[model samples]
Target: MDLANLHFQNPEAFFLLLLGPLLILDWWWHAHKRKSTIKFPALAIAKKAAKGSKVRARYIVPALRMAALCCFVVALARPQNATEVEYTSTDGVDIMLALDVSGSMGTLDMLTRTDQAKLGVMNAEKVLKSGRFWDYSRLGYAKNVMAEFVQKRESDRIGLSVFAGNSYTLVPLTLDYGALLEILQAVDDSSASGNGTAIGDGLMNSLARLEKSDAKSKVVVLLTDGIDNASLVPPLHAAEVAKALGVKVYTIGVGKKSGTFLAFQQNPWTGEISWGEQPIPAENSLDEKTLSQIASSTGGRFYRAESKDDLEKIYSEIDGLEKTEIQTIAYARYQEKFYPWLLVGALLILLELVLANTRFVRIP
Candidate 1:
């Protein structure tokens, strides 16, 4: 009865519907043309009494026949119910997030519990350093943004590599994002023992994780705040190896080195908060030249993020660059729906015949 998605299998059969109306016109013409002779008195009372229920119902037989003819035409058309369905298949990409957790990551640039953007500037060079701003530090913002990036990679296999003076893998390339997030959150800055920034070692460590990958496209996203100082393997050499293996390495230099920044600390026992200034030295500035060379050598881009928002946008850009195009296939399934119409047509025809012979038969 819901014809919204209905269809016909044998549509040409509907041509038979022309017969019903033709039969009706023929019945009307013959009823008018046929002549009958019967002698009877012309009485008004008799004419009024003749218009009884049974007399009126004499036309019901022909109406039933016409309705039956319509049903037959519909039955022949072979109506059906069809529903369409579709599915998508994606050629997935593989990615690795190379993070820098050097001692410099503890230097606060503006990320705080209150999301203050210019915290360091407002309280510039107060000259005190506090280790209590753990969640509002550079490392914390990187981890939070990286977690969001992971969520956007629908079917890609992603891994994590962390480095400072030493580099190592925290999670292998896997599709289980839940397990990866658990380990990523538990990591600390340089294990509190690392001394220098080993940028080359970080890239090489990430490349090693992607060495055996068979994905159509492979990528490494590396972020660091300080210059490379203690890597056994040089950064350019690692970039050559990545290029040879058909892997792209995107590098990000985080934090602003324009002026002095303020660092804050809270007294653990008294719960009092205090702030002081910290200046950026030329030696500890981000090694943008080497990082840029690494990215270009591997056919990737380099980005500079001076704030949390900039870093998020950089990650978003990389995510957009490596996304896989999803292709969908569609088809339809049909179910036969003509049986009820056929059955109704047959029942109507039978009822018409029975009524014509038993209650409205003509003596011809």
Candidate 2:
């Protein structure tokens, strides 16, 4: 029981407290009016003797009785301790993140961060020296950004699906963001061993997960850097299926217009080889028209991400567009505290009776 939350259940019973003062006043008035006559002269000696004796101590009995009466009245008021409980009912959205892990994701075009302050990546020279090869790739940047995005959603149920020449659902819709990010971070270019991009299969797999969802708002955020080259299902047919299922699909294309490619050469006489980066026109095999059509068909948007910052901004925009709904209810539970007060009042009254009869008794 919390003493701080104590309150009276029946406050009207407190009117009994007025009886204590009235009883004290009546005792005082009677004692004052009833006076005895003395026939002896020089009464100063008798008054001095009475003043120095223990006669005044007898008033303790009445004081104890008054205190016991106050306790009994408070106990009758029925004090209680109140405890509050709060519960939330969330109507959250179900989201599926479809990622492309084709071999083209290994390109170093938008992966190398010149401004360390922006993406918080290690220096290019350090990454090369440390043999952390994937740190300078598109897949690495995408995984980092997606992990951060997952942390921002609190109430939403998120799922993951990765694809290359084929598609696989890495996780089902769940509220466990930690486990989902763990699986996402472990994904690399080797995750999809096949050599071609299967955009249709990816979307179909994502839709398969969303199809089972009972959420009011179902969505898919599909990201890719290549055109569909190997898929059993057609991209347009997949979009039609998404529309029929009432699922929105947001598509994001990642890459720059112009980027660098690694060129390698071998010394014929010395039998040595060296590799250097060469400037090349970026190959954007990404089918932007089809991606836009898919997005439009499902009442979603299409975004182009040329840099890491652009990708982050696109994800942030999507996060803002899909908001979760939550409702909270609060109530209190009260426990009866009158039992302890009743026991204490009874003990006090009993103690007063015992002391009055023995140590502080008076003659009638």
The best candidate by TM-score is 2
lDDT of 1 by residue, 212-273 (tens): 99888999999899988989999999999999999999999988876665566576898665
What TM-scores do the predictions have? 0.77, 0.83
lDDT of 2 by residue, 1-364 (tens): 2245787878888898888889899978987887776575768876676442456776776787787788788788888888889999888899999999997876666744463333243344444445354655677778889898999999999999999999999999999999999999899767775779999999999999999799989999999998888889988899999999999999999876566744334568975544456574545457899999999999999999877888899999999999888899998878888887778778878887897888766554
Query: Which residue segments of model 2 deviate by more than 4 Å?
Result: 1-4, 29-48, 51-53, 113-131, 259-275, 278-283
What is the alpha-carbon lDDT of model 1 when measured against the actual structure? Answer: 0.83
Ten residues in a row with the worst lDDT in model 1? Answer: 123-132
Off by over 4 Å in 1: 1-3, 25-52, 110-132, 153-155, 174-179, 190-195, 212-216, 230-232, 263-274
Clash count, one per candidate:
6, 0
260 Cα displacement, candidate 2 (Å): 3.3
Instruction: Tell how far residue 134 is off in model 2, in angstroms.
Output: 2.6
